[model samples]
Target: MNAADSSALVVFSGGQDSTTCLAWALSHYERVETIGFWYGQRHAVEMECREPIRQGVARLSPLWASRLGPDRVIPLDVLGEVSVSALTADLLVASSRTDGLPATFVPGRNLVFLTFAAIAAFQRGLKRVVTGVCETDFSGYPDCRDDTIKALQTALNLGLNSRLVLETPLMWIDKAETWTLAEALGGDGLVELIVHETHTCYNGDRRTWQEWGFGCGQCDACRLRSAGWQRYSQARSWRVWD
Candidate 1:
């Protein structure tokens, strides 16, 4: 794609991967916009978290507004009737396997988000979409696989009135690589940006994360993120982890 056509949109969640993707989008695209899903998942808590996220992005890089505009954040309520995700209920999102799509899969979560992002991008004359859907360190989510993403990309392009490409920078990269990528972009400072901001709790416990922004520390998200933090720490210290 030409430089001007490099404009893109990111499926933002104010969470770890999405926050990183938000930063990545700011750096990668000539024009970058974002779409945030507002599916009924613990409303007030989630919305409260998002306010600071938007402000954080704006404070860190005002150019984000220049590219995508600060008001472009879309709060979509698409998965209202769907009672499929743990993020909305008390049942823990079970095993990290793929025998079948899990209840926590959030049925059509990414599909809905991406489709909307594509639609928004198409309308705005933007054609590239970026998301941070990593299979590694992810809980064996079917939606995160290369095939799923490719299929979605094709479906979006064919079904939409215009063409679009969904870019997944963190698709193949593991948590460690994600950490490395963040560092490459902004160094340990981005690590701080990640620490103070991103939410990775399955139980939605804010207390567990007040000081360090860590969740249960055992869920797939926290474990993977911890590994990334440790690796970055060791690299900085050059001291063997014991």
Candidate 2:
């Protein structure tokens, strides 16, 4: 990307991945804009998590706002239409991870979000877009794969005809690796920032860091976060001796 033309738009859910993506965005793009969604998720606090991210960006070294300017925090309130998530129901919320795709999967969610965000980026005269979706932690989400992203990128370019680059910074990184990358990119406190500050729980519980910023212990989000933090924390401790 030309330094003169490095403006970008990021799909930010204000969650652990997205917030780290935002910080990563600030490092590369000359200007960064954030696009958030409120797609009737079972837990509303996910949207509210955007606040600390906004604050974190403000506290960056060069200052995120100074680089990205003001971001567009879009709150898409299609509460009734987006009922595909397993997080929408009660009983299933406890036992819905056995299937191939998993019920917690939101139907066409990232698709819709990225499509809309692409339009937003185009409208703003920006050529680049960043998302934090990862195949490493997809569990079963088809949209998080690099193949899917690349295919979508091709179709989007054909339709838009203006060169829209969709980049997934976390495409190949697992949860522990993602934490490591965020730390490498944002310094030592990156993992803490994501675990304690950013929210990704489907149950919307901010009860403790043991869940590792994910919603509930039962959900996939919580499971991934739980395992990752455990491994990362222990590995960090061992590294202190090495």
Candidate 3:
């Protein structure tokens, strides 16, 4: 399928990476829609930021505004009900004893997300599904791995008997490169929108405003974002200096 003419559905979480992926989709595809999930996350505020981010992204370019389609929010509260993690519960964020993965790793979260995204894509006749799951500069979630996404993509296509394409624009890149990609896709405005509108705090603390964005600045998510922003900013500064 020609990506320039294809339609895509983005699995947006109103976070930095997903928002970047959304911009990437809008830049590449002819039509792009977004789908968010409410799994009773501790940082449910991310859902609230979805619409505003969509509007902000659309305002970036007339082409994007024209190509951007409707948004959908799926109620996957069952995942939260069935899983015990720092993201779903009030427990402190740490590593698990068995696998050393972060406590924020909601088991099977991405798997279920991709499955439902496929269903939504099938219903909407969207041939491509975009996600922001990354292995680099992430909290070590197994489902976010490239291998896992590829496997799930194969399973989804076989189970649905459809030619749905799973797209991960941020899979191999780190957070700094993610920022760079967003800038490349939409320029400084997009970066500013991501910093001001997107929510990535695992603690759901919208109170503290960091240079990277709004976050508690202490959680794993915040640290990754902050570090990435620092690297991204420093790199840009050095380029300007050169």
Indicate which candidate wins on lDDT: 3
Tens digit per residue, CA lDDT, model 3, 1-242: 57543899999999999999999999989989999999999999999999999999999999999999999999999999998898999888755536787889898999999999999999988999999988888888889999998999899999999888899988889999999999999999999999999999999999898888899998888998989999999999998999
Candidate 1 local lDDT, 1-242, one digit each (tens) = 58658787787777778777877887777777777777777522544566577567656655664665443555545575664566665656544324465546676777787888888888878778888888777876678888999999998888885668889989888776777777676556666777876776665556676433747776656677788777766675763453
Predicted candidate 1, C-alpha RMSD: 3.3
lDDT digits (tens) for residues 23-68 of candidate 2:
8888888888888877667777877778776776667565665886
Output the TM-score of candidate 1.
Answer: 0.85
Q: In candidate 1, how many Å is residue 22 off?
A: 1.4
Clashes of each: 0, 3, 0
- TM-scores, one per candidate: 0.85, 0.90, 0.97
Stretches of candidate 2 above 4 Å error? 1-4, 63-65, 79-83, 88-91, 97-99
Highest TM-score, which number? Answer: 3
Q: Candidate 2: lDDT of 131?
A: 97
> Against the correct fold, how does model 3 do in TM-score?
0.97
Worst 10 residues of 3 by lDDT: 93-102
Worst 10 residues of 2 by lDDT: 89-98
Task: State which candidate, 1 or 3, has the greater lDDT.
Answer: 3
Screening candidate 3 with a backbone cut-off below 3 angstroms (N, C-alpha, C), the clashing residue pairs are none
Q: Which residue pairs in model 1 clash with each other?
A: none
